[model samples]
Target: MLKSEFAKTFAMLATGLSCVLMAQNTLADAPEHRIINLQAEATREVANDEMQATLYTELNEKDAATLANKINSIVNQAMNTAKSYPKVEIKTGGQNTYPVYNDKQQLVNWRGRAEVILNSQDFKQTSELIAKLQESMQLGNINFEVSAEQRNKVESELYIEASKAFQQRAKLLLAPWGASNYELVNLQLNANANRPMPIYAARDASFKADSIESQNIEAGNSEITVIANGSIQLK
Candidate 1:
């Protein structure tokens, strides 16, 4: 009888210890009904401070080398012309050469295109360079965006504002719940740009190199929004 009683007591103690460890692990995360979701956002419209444009010269020839040479010559001239605009940055974009197929499926000739890209903060200078280059190469596309420096500055400011707003809202909500304080269980910060996209009449026959003139451009605006989304546990 003594041996049986001792065995039963040890079994009970071991079972209790296992249950305690399991309960502790289960409660490691926040308890039910203790978590609350909150979200705050701040937004600002900033003028687009940068521009990028692509120009390309396409040609066809009996030989691939001849086509490439013609395309390269036109692009080199375009880059050289862009050098006149000190504020604009000019770089080679891409060059592609492919075989041209005839009605008989014969690879009769080679078609190629050499491209150049222009980047600048000065819209006037960029437009002028585009007009000059358009005299040779055709305009491909144009895009406007906020510069990196300005974007970073605006996003930093908005993050602080959004975080503070989130904290304030949390405190206000807790006051109604009769809770003295709350814990920040999780937080997520995000930013997105809502801006109008620039449209261009690229590759249109009406926009031929000989008929095109200086382009009118607008910098427009981009809305930079920062959102603070998170959940907090009531204390």
Candidate 2:
């Protein structure tokens, strides 16, 4: 073979090898880092299947002992009356005695306030008990609440929803940067319940007769909001 031809052959082989090396390096050196961030929120409405109410009864007694007995009878009767509702849980509550002051700052009489809280899973039953308690022990204000079981279930669903939203956001953010593949490095979930307004007027027994009517009670929707945050990496 001629020396020139041999040299030309070697040059051609070197050029092909260089092209292969360059292509391999380009693939390996593809984008190594990218910015991917996402945010999401979720909400759910739950019906309040449970109910709570604070019932107060005030009595005026000439003697402490007699007043105690009288107040006890009123509370006991009210509690027992509440038991008539198969779904209601009746429990004894407050007992207090204080001196009543007159306009001249003189002791007019002894005032005793007795009370109990009625809790039930049945909304209608709870409402009826509150109304009837007023006729007897003079029902006080009624505050509403949700059961523990229901709240936990709602919160779990909310968390799942929030996680889905975060994932969607991360995908959207990464799409523009040419990165759609990612794994959740970390995830956090938070949730809470808000208390309902207190019923102060229910404590007023000035018109027990008028209060006999079932209090117009509406168990408003409880909001469960879930927030999830996590870091994602895309290539």
Candidate 3:
């Protein structure tokens, strides 16, 4: 029995030593905690591909129902006119009706306003349509933007460029520290797009539709940017 107990004790000691060696090996294989953080950006200016416009109609009437009906009629007519052009998308915007008050706090008349919005990639068609619609409605504003597909394409290319730039910068920075090799610890990419300012030009009410010329529109450049940020560990 004494010999058997001594053998069991020896086995326990061996097992404990093996576990300690394994723990030490694991500690040695762990990655270093040191890292370098960096950021790089790429930008490109591309012409805008999309256009948006809003048309408004306002009227005042003694009867609220009449004023609402008149506004609805104008919006419906605008929608019908826009249907001829398959490329231009038309939608109704805000429709508001409020009562005008006199100095004596008496309700004078009901004033109502309605909006018709237009969006398209064909600038020529859009301008022509707007000119025709101006006969009954007033121009609110015009805006230009890069389409989603175009912006995405530009951003994808910029992302690659920005990432490469980040890597180059990291190498340059690490060369002074004698770090010839690096491993990417983490990375993040972000994309941004700048929209052009809206143009607000009112049309002359006295101008006839036949005499009015189509608006000349220029799709200004939109700046697309991509940024890369992350940390790299020196080897």
Backbone clashes for every candidate come to: 0, 3, 0
Local accuracy of candidate 2 as per-residue lDDT tens digits, 89-205: 877776899888889998777889987887888877776776677676665666666688988888888888898889778877766777758767667778876666765663454
- Report the number of the highest-TM-score candidate: 3
lDDT of 1 by residue, 1-235 (tens): 9999999999999999999999899888746567889999999999999998888888989998888778888977887887789999999988889998989999999989888988999887787777777777788888899999999999999999999999999999887787889999899999988866765644662444443453456678999999999998887
RMSD of 1: 4.4
The 10-residue segment with the lowest total lDDT in model 1: 205-214
Ranking by TM-score: 3, 1, 2
Model 1, stretches more than 4 Å misplaced? 1-33, 203-216
Worst 10-residue lDDT window for candidate 2 reads 202-211
Q: What lDDT would each prediction earn against the true structure?
A: 0.85, 0.76, 0.88
Query: Residue-wise lDDT of candidate 3 within 63-124, one digit each (tens)?
Result: 99999889999999999999888899999999899999999999999999999999999887
For lDDT, the strongest prediction is: 3
TM-scores of the models, in the order given: 0.82, 0.70, 0.82
In the order shown, the candidates' Cα RMSDs to the true structure are 4.4, 9.7, 4.8
What is the full ranking by lDDT, best candidate first? Answer: 3, 1, 2
Winner on TM-score between 1 and 3 is 3
